[model samples]
Target: MNRFLLVILFLFFALGAFAMGQKAVVNLDEYLLSNTKSGYTNVMVEDMVFSWKLQGQDIFVKIFAPLEGWLAIGFDPAEKMKGADYIIGIISNGAPMINEHYGDNPYGHKSIVLLGGKDLTGNKEGLENKDGTMIGFSIPQDPQDNFHKKLLPGSTHKVILAYGADKNMKARHAKRYIIEIKL
Candidate 1:
């Protein structure tokens, strides 16, 4: 009986931790296809265009921009990139790739931490425009990582849309804007 009690206690704590983490993993293709989500579109000064759909706590976003190199959409940009998260989409070697990163005010390796890398192909997709590539992805309304900023529903936040020449994210961007998200 004691051993069974201990096991139950352990499971309870583990489940609690997972729920608090707020990771909320979601499949991009499944979420988009399951809902008849009306697209909410936004445009930046640099012509980097994006649209997002919100269903419950899931947010599906797609970004398309004119870039000789790469395009990115960042969330919660303030003062710098100190407390912002961004997903960069690039066409590399005739393929579409996605990288999740968090900015710590500066745009460099030391200031940014990578979360995950994704490939846009098959069911997980977006159209690649001639001028730029489109990347479709999904993130939670509330991120699990304590290091990232929180995305609140019905409330807008600062956003950054940028593009640069280097795939390494080292080049000076052709355009960068600290705009507001259309929440």
Candidate 2:
């Protein structure tokens, strides 16, 4: 009787596992056929573009621009940005991180935040919140530590206003305005 009982238990567990496998197969098929962006709630497939903004603009989600300040940008983490990249224009610095066209490319890396029901493909370089909000400042790869320190944890703005840098590692000679983000 004990052996019979053991056989029954084993069969029950095997049936449960089989049921789970069937459910997984159904969900996978639905995901690939679905059109709505699930915010990456499903699998971690590569090379998909998702975009959102803090404030709406023709370009990226535009942030605050000031006469005596700099451009700051922020966005939501719900956007699945697997293949997307960002480009930030600066008011200061010659943009050593510029592209072949000598244009500023601040977000050359993937900046997707995986909160708010999203999964991460690659880690982004900035502050991320559990609810999928991201804040990033457009600065050169080698900037004064003061600049980075200024963008510490609780800062409300993401970009700054200033002038472009000169050949001497100083942004004192050029007028720079514009922070562009490519999705």
Candidate 3:
């Protein structure tokens, strides 16, 4: 009878530990949703949510869209898409990937590395779930690149938010918008 009781207690503790572990693993969508009230300025455009916070010399950004494809944000364009600095995040091959890009013309963009510019992207993360896709990343306020613009805290700038319908980066955006935001 004592051995039986011991076995029951061990199983109970094991199950409790397993449950705790599951709770400890955070869902990316839940984390991004929680940040809406946590020092992040959130903007809702259509079905997308753009959130950002400036901390020290770096700006942290999070984007949540109801798509399973790629999401991107462009900082200050010259004309149309010309001379814009873009950061794109996608879940490729079941993993998160980020790439820095430069708008070379009025209608298109290419990778910054391919354009002979240094990559300025900081830590990036992406996740795709039943609800949607979420991407979070960080970039310096002053990237010191010709194609990128300085993001001053008190300045207002034009930002472009776009997302595709699939994971193909070369595909056209399913939806895009331009908005003026004060950093």
For TM-score, the strongest prediction is: 3
Error of 1 at 55 (Å): 2.1
> lDDT per model, in order?
0.62, 0.26, 0.84
lDDT by residue (5-122, candidate 1, tens digit) is 9999999999999888763333334334433345544443546666676657667777766544677777775547555677776766656677676665566322234334322212
Per-residue accuracy of model 3 over 9-59 as CA lDDT, tens digit each: 999999999887652333545665688667888888787888999988889
What value of lDDT does candidate 3 attain over all alpha carbons?
Answer: 0.84
* Candidate 3 clash pair list: none
TM-score of each: 0.64, 0.20, 0.81
How far off is residue 107 in model 2, in Å? Answer: 8.1
For candidate 2, the clash count comes to 16
- Judging by lDDT against the true structure, name the best candidate: 3
Candidate 2, position 27, lDDT: 37
The CA-based lDDT of model 1 is what?
Answer: 0.62
Better TM-score candidate (2, 3): 3
TM-score of model 1 relative to the true fold? 0.64
Candidate 2 local Cα displacement, residue 114, angstroms: 19
lDDT of 2 at 31: 33
Better candidate number, 1 or 2, judged by lDDT:
1
